[model samples]
Target: MTISLPVTVSPRLSKKASRHLKERFIEFLLFGAAAISVFTTVAIVYVLVKESWNFFQHVPLSDFLFDTQWTPLFDDAHYGIMVLLSGTLTSSAVALVIAIPLGTIIAIYLSEFASFRVREIAKPFLELLGGVPTIVYGYFALTLLTPVLQILFPDLPGFSLLSAGLVMGIMIIPYVSSLSEDAMRAVPMSLREGSYAMGATRFQTAVKVVMPAATSGIASAYILGISRAVGETMILAVAAGMQPNLTFNPTEPGATITSYIVQVALGDLPHGSIGYQTIFAAGLTLMLMTLVFNLIGAWLRKKYREVY
Candidate 1:
């Protein structure tokens, strides 16, 4: 006999359905937050590129590219890109030097060597370093770091690339350590166990087996960290003076592309002037630099990504 079932839901059942709807709403909001990031990137790129194209139209490409001088306010000048490029490369290279080894080793130590209790305590503290403001690092570089550097190298200038680069390096160490640690930790415990079972010591197993396996992840972290170092502005502004000289002397004062724009933007350069356009051009250059690093990081992740 077929019996008709009554359409009924208890209060508890209805409440559960409401809860599921609320949960879905929250999940959707979180995904929307991620979507906004892509929008932000696009907006910034549009502004930079649009204004930069306007700049290139007015300023001759040859003078901006081949000229070895940059005097936007002077009677005659050459706004060559090499000077700012030098500053970016200098700071980034110095940071890479300090970050790669320190970050990689710390990552290894934290993931493989530190006790469980130690790791629990260490990770948050290490990540905290990365969260510190870049401006604070800049201040520390100018006031604290500069004085110490002067004592160490008497001939060095007060505000120079050395001070900025070193500060930037210290600032980025946390990023490298934290990200690389995650990569190293992703390796299966079984891999380490197998290496150990083959009579390898902990360090040997880490270097010979685990590290090699996690190479792609580490490389990706390194590239991303490099990108951070390159794009950093505050430290360069405070410690590295705004003098865009075509020299690689770390002891000499020099300006990064960012510092130059900041200097110009601070009412010194009026809107719609050729000088104003210079900033946009500089922004485009910086954008391209960042894009290059991002591509490199992506390539590394794809090429060396480990499943296990």
Candidate 2:
């Protein structure tokens, strides 16, 4: 009796089978990556809430929110976050005031007015400013800009919110300009042609047509710049001072939430201690502020996105 051997087919022997398997494998990898990112964000939120809860249990929420002082390291420790919040807002406001107009002007020039040669030359230099180290910017604020400001205003402190904010503004300029320019450039050339045909000059077309078309993207860029200014650490720590001042004076030394976190991190505080927990609580607040900015940015992009 003859016995027939069973036949086995290799997947590679069939091109369609191999292609199907490869597609499924690639799909799995993409899904895994997306899931990891989602879970990572969830994990971060969970950790922040858990640690912040522990902190609030020890310190009353009212005191943390409303107290005018933030001397958490002192014997008569106060948990007031407003002092830090004031400094954060003050510096951020200054940064926005400086960055918004300058950045928008730069974007407009690059997108509308600059010749191809000029734009190519200018954009790289603008982006180069962003590549400079934050630590260097901090030092520049501390040594160069602060002295110059002191010359202008004799009463300004060596480390003031004004100097820090100015330097931070300089740092954020590229981010705003680059994003806004890209948005403005993305506006269809047809819009410009239409405007030109209807008795519009280059300036008029850019201001009336392109600006409105790219408003959402420009707004998102500003929001991201604000987020950057808020979350910045080294520059604020180096030039904005570590003193928690409740006043909104730019010339005064003040601590931001970011500065406070840096201060705590540099110390040798024991794990799970009140001091350690303080940083976590402050971190959660910072996280929430950034989250709000990001949410607003996403909403603006969705609401105002131009199909063209």
Candidate 3:
């Protein structure tokens, strides 16, 4: 004989509850997405470190560091990392020399000088250039660029770092120019107007006022270009002959750490073998090199960051 009454939530309160639940759901989704990337990066680093540790166990750290020859596959294996390091450095140097100056100039032109019509038309072309496969560029370097280089200097080998580096620079030009131009264009128009009021020429405004204001973003672009140059694989693999030599000569054919890894990866080396383990060690080295460059870039950005 109990009298029971049901209690119901008000419409407003129910609606608010629903909204709160939806917001939490969206936030959780975003958090999950971010966590995926972090987890993947951590997993990659763990694998590389684990395998590299296994490699170091078999090869002494001193010999790996101090050796001048890299013949890990040969019967008398010598693990001088410098042989690959030299090639990597030389090729990267050549690429940077071409990319930095050219990309900066292109960015300045597009950002400051190009009309709206020209900008619209040119941007797509630049993006298209970036989208082309790296393998096509590799073959172009081998078949076309190498022949052209031979005409200029007959002593230039068919498969040399110069050919590979030059092509790689061209391939990455869009990456540098596009990012740099975007950074430059992001500079406030008021800054340019102020420079003009101060009797600065268009070139002066672009070079001095705008460029300094956009330093952080431009530094980021340069860093991306450096990373691209350092990590380029097929162009160096197919164009630069896969020969391990400890020399900083771009005109000569040599093997980079990347090319060596590719060679070993495509070969039938058994898993867990010493030769197979070298790829992980080389990968760790490459990752360290990229990390150093990124740190330098970060420092540059911090040192030159502009609030306005």
Candidate 4:
């Protein structure tokens, strides 16, 4: 009788239950985190789109999109975003010109050629640039950087896009260099050895073999760096001035979208006014542009990860 009753339950079934419970818990945790991030992102986009729609309801979409003059403070309104877009792109492009080559070169030296001691010293110094408060960079760009650039281009405007862009570039160098170095370091030692065995010089191996391997990662970092440059506000606000000039003159004062938002917020612009709503629309535009950059970066990283 005892033997007959014993077969109904087994130790295997108990262990299986425990493992199933643990796996479910882990799955729920992962799903919860992803859900939270997705929900937050959607919520933000929803708010921006909703508010921006309200803006467009009163101010025609065509005028907002096409008007050259960005005078949002008129009975006959022209909510042209081109001026703000111009400012954002100008600052980002200028920062890119300064950041890309320098950061990439430094990353190469650190990952491929620098002695251990030099890397130890330089890594901390570079990371320190990122930690410095953006507001401080703003102050420096306004007071010190503007003066220095003015001395070089004395005929140019003091608080110009060039000055803000340069400071923004310095701030972003840590981002690009650190990420690019990681990408470079990920190349297999065997590959480098293989190239060396082929009688290639160190420089040739680094330039051809290592760089090709790491190109995707480097491109991702570069795109993210540009996103940072585009989103920057304080340095542009303080050093680039609040003039939203839709021209490519780097030597002239120009305002970015963030700077324009700051200018609008600081003034006592009434709620529900075109001025108040314009910032939200501009913000939505900025968010969309940065989102595009992030998407491109992610794609590049996924593509180039194994090509080396």
The best candidate by lDDT is: 3
Candidate 4: what lDDT?
Answer: 0.88
lDDT of model number 2: 0.93
lDDT of 3 by residue, 202-303 (tens): 999999999999999999999999999989999999999999989898999999999999999889999999999999999999999999999999999899
Q: Could you give candidate 1's per-residue lDDT for residues 172-224 as a string of tens digits?
A: 98888888888888999999999999999989998999899998889888987
Considering only N, C-alpha and C atoms within 3 Å, which residue pairs clash in candidate 3?
67-80
Point out where model 2 deviates above 4 Å.
1-34
Clashes in candidate 4: how many?
1
| Candidate 1 to truth, TM | 0.88
What C-alpha lDDT values do all the predictions have? 0.86, 0.93, 0.93, 0.88
As a whole number from 0 to 100, the lDDT of residue 49 in candidate 3 is 99
lDDT per residue (tens digit) for residues 1-308 in model 2: 99999998896686697789999999999999889988999999999899899999999999999998888989999999999989999999988888988999999999999999999999999989999999999999999999999999999988999999999999999999999999999999999999999999889988999999999989999998999999988999999889889989888999999999999999899989899999999999999999999999999989998886
- Cα lDDT tens digits, model 4, 29-67, are 999988998899899989889889899888787877788
Candidate 4: C-alpha RMSD after superposition: 3.4
Q: For each candidate, give its TM-score against the true structure.
A: 0.88, 0.91, 0.92, 0.89
In candidate 3, which residue ranges exceed 4 Å CA deviation?
1-30
